[model samples]
Target: MTETARTRYFLLAILLIALAAAWPELSQPGLLNTRGGGDSPFLLQRLQQLETAVLDGHFPVRWMPDANYGYGYPFYNFYAPLSIYITFLFRLIGFSFVRSIHLSHLLGYFVAGWGMFLLARRWFAHGGAGNGWAGLLAAAAYTVAPFHLVNVYVRGDSLAEFWAMAFYPLVILAADGLFGGGRRGVALFGLAYAGLILSHNISALIFSPFLLLYLLLRMRFLTKKQENYPQACTEQSRSISQITQIGFFKSYKNLRNLCNLRIANPIFGFLLALALAAWFFVPALAEQSLAQLDAVTSGYFYYSNHFLGTADQPLIQSTFFVDYGVVDREAFRMGLVQTAVSAAGL
Candidate 1:
């Protein structure tokens, strides 16, 4: 709300947008070129298909009629097409296809940082004396994170995956809001979870358990806080303790009693996500046998080589071509600064 806070956010956004295009494609308008530069090649065509589907009044828009050598491909049926659909919306607003692609990615980067800033704000500033500089640090760190850069620039893996991962923080933010015992974030959690699912099914699958775990952890914290508030308040006989609960944890009174907490907020959020994403996953699952899903269990996905490695051992040594002749093997790194800070925090 303050001018200083606005300035922090503006500066962070500018830095993130600049980072999105720092690579500078050799022969494309977007950040990444289409000359075998990850998935950029087919993304525009998908955009075109989405636009045609809209014009033809197809409700769900499953089949890509122009794909598969004129026989058509069921692209949208299995692959979540929300990101392409966003590009289509950009198309509707009179931007050229290339411009839409550029804007969509730039928006993804900006929104990702914005969401991180909000989460950081709540984390470092909630119920305490804090400043936006902490949020700026968090937002900037997230925006420049290496793996995220891979998703947006290097690998350009899937636009859907990028957006799915980008919005993941907002899901946690909503959960955090709910943990404080209010309906403030129920709708946001629902919509964000649904959109994440529709953005990329595999990512949704990967992120779902963590979301559940975070909800459970928050719930436990809330319950403990509420149950102990009375006892802590009754301790008026002693001086206020400071150093006993860690620097941040030294302030338990900040969380308050959370007396209005209902155990149903997270349940409602889960139900809403399921309801919204059922339209996509219901068919994706029920019709699984009809597709070549059996292939997922074999070949590259065979269990023998997929074991989670121990601390002394490295896991998978996988690599993917990110550009015409450029292969990226270290796409999974979280960056040195992030890794150090995260470990310190833990």
Candidate 2:
């Protein structure tokens, strides 16, 4: 197929997957039931409050006056606010609170699928390794991946994290472009990384190392050096001093090549992302100690104590049945079909 036809076909597939994934919410417009227990209602309230605050000249939107029974709480100041901001925009464009939340969730799936397609296309197209079909399959596999469905259906209230997850592929693709010598790639990387950070701080923190490692792997080709001396060069063929001098020159040339724009661009992108997200992260870091941050990680919620395998539930049972409560511990198995397809791809 022509490039335009291929692009359109992939987009159509992404849209269909998005629609299917969000059918439950779309089918029942006013239904706001979620596995988040009371958290969903509180999130809705917070979004409404944030909208009002911004409209009423709250610049940073740090404090929520109605929270804590009107004593006020600095929730948004430390919390990731991009998802809420998107919901606010949806509300501004005449969507109801419930509809806005559902739409945001739906949009996350679409963006993630599209981003995965972009990355896979680039990966397969590199050195003519594969074709558009590979990218399409990848996009389908990622969109229908069980973890994404679980996030939307189970942890619906945590839209920020879901949004952050959606941006992961975009960040990878943009980083790939930056390392591949695309001039606009640095700006794209900065924007995507900033979006990921603004969506969820923890996801950004976890994914940053992976992004750096990917850049490092890609830079290897650029930094690799050819051995000027032959492998069979015996002591008789070349003097020790001459061999040392040749090795030194090769090393210096490799070092000089490594110092070029390809290596520097990705680093610049990372710095730019930090600069873009400074408004949220700077104050959040500065004032974190003042808040009851410990309370968040204390008691039953302690990270170290709640390992995944602690539960006695069987994998088969957990895989199919959706837990009504404690959705975090819900069956996390990607469906058999998805797993098989993924393995086939591998």
Candidate 3:
């Protein structure tokens, strides 16, 4: 509402517009060609399979072997269905299936800008000590983060990663509210968890443990406070403390309390994300592919073998050629350098 605040938002708006304009080029059928790089073809194949399913009204599982993908390939059993369902909805709007898939990704990245704004506002609320400047700082920092540039330049990986990262802090906040005993807030917590899980399973997995750790610490604090209450009103407190302390005698006691507390909702959220592919949890759970894991691990080894082993190697050796086009290896190099400089600034 002040002049400085207006200036900050204005700059953010301009940066967002620039990001939006860059999307089409990054994902254009031919230009900036990273789509043919390792694991990329598999992602595109999965999307193409979804497009086919949307057209045929049938789900197909074996478009390609999972061994060609990254760490989260087993989760494709989950991702495929979600993508098909969404593509179908877009088709209903008269868009071609291929266009729909591309548009979905483009729009997903575009909306991420708004998510960045929300994150910044939330950070400002806490870190700014209620000052507007803090929020603006967060927004600008997020907008210019090297990761955002990578997400924008690389098309397929952008949507899910951006969505997951953008919504990650909100998931923490919602879970925080739920653990605080506001039942209605728990539903929002559930919604945020569900959304992120659906967007990207691996990203969700990486985030889930952190979410659980935070919740456990917060809940323990609450329990401690309750224990300090009058004895007549602390029946639950006594019972919970006894259960947690029971582990002093038996390791299983801790497991029993964990089951009772259902402290694993974060894990459940991780598993539930598999619903993007199947109706019941079991079917998706079963289809997770170990081959995908192998492929991902190999890719990492490939990258490390080339880069870390020899510093004087061609800077471009670490880069993969995706199809007929070339990635700007220098852009990546500069991006990392800039990122380090930016973090130091922070």
Q: Which structure among the candidates has the greatest lDDT?
A: 2
lDDT of 3 at 90: 66
lDDT of 1 at 296: 68
lDDT of 2: 0.73
CA lDDT, every model vs. true structure: 0.66, 0.73, 0.50
Tens-place lDDT per residue, model 3, 1-346, is: 7756765665567456545545565455542445455333434555555555435654444332334453223334544234334544666788754565555544554445445555456545664535345544455555545555555455444445655655675676566545423234435666777777666656776787887788778668767666322321233233345544656325545444543454433333333344432352355556555334455447643434434224543432233322213353333333334545556877
In the range 125-236, model 1's lDDT, one tens digit per residue, is 7535354567666777676666566665665546887888677888888777654334445567888888888998877877889988887787677677764334323232
Q: Which residue pairs in model 1 clash with each other?
A: none
Which of the two, 2 or 3, has more lDDT?
2
Ranking by lDDT: 2, 1, 3
Candidate 2 clashes between residue pairs 3 or more apart in a chain or in different chains? none
Give the residue spans of candidate 3 off by over 4 A: 1-32, 35-45, 59-89, 96-102, 126-133, 155-159, 216-281, 288-337, 344-346
lDDT of 3 at 42: 37
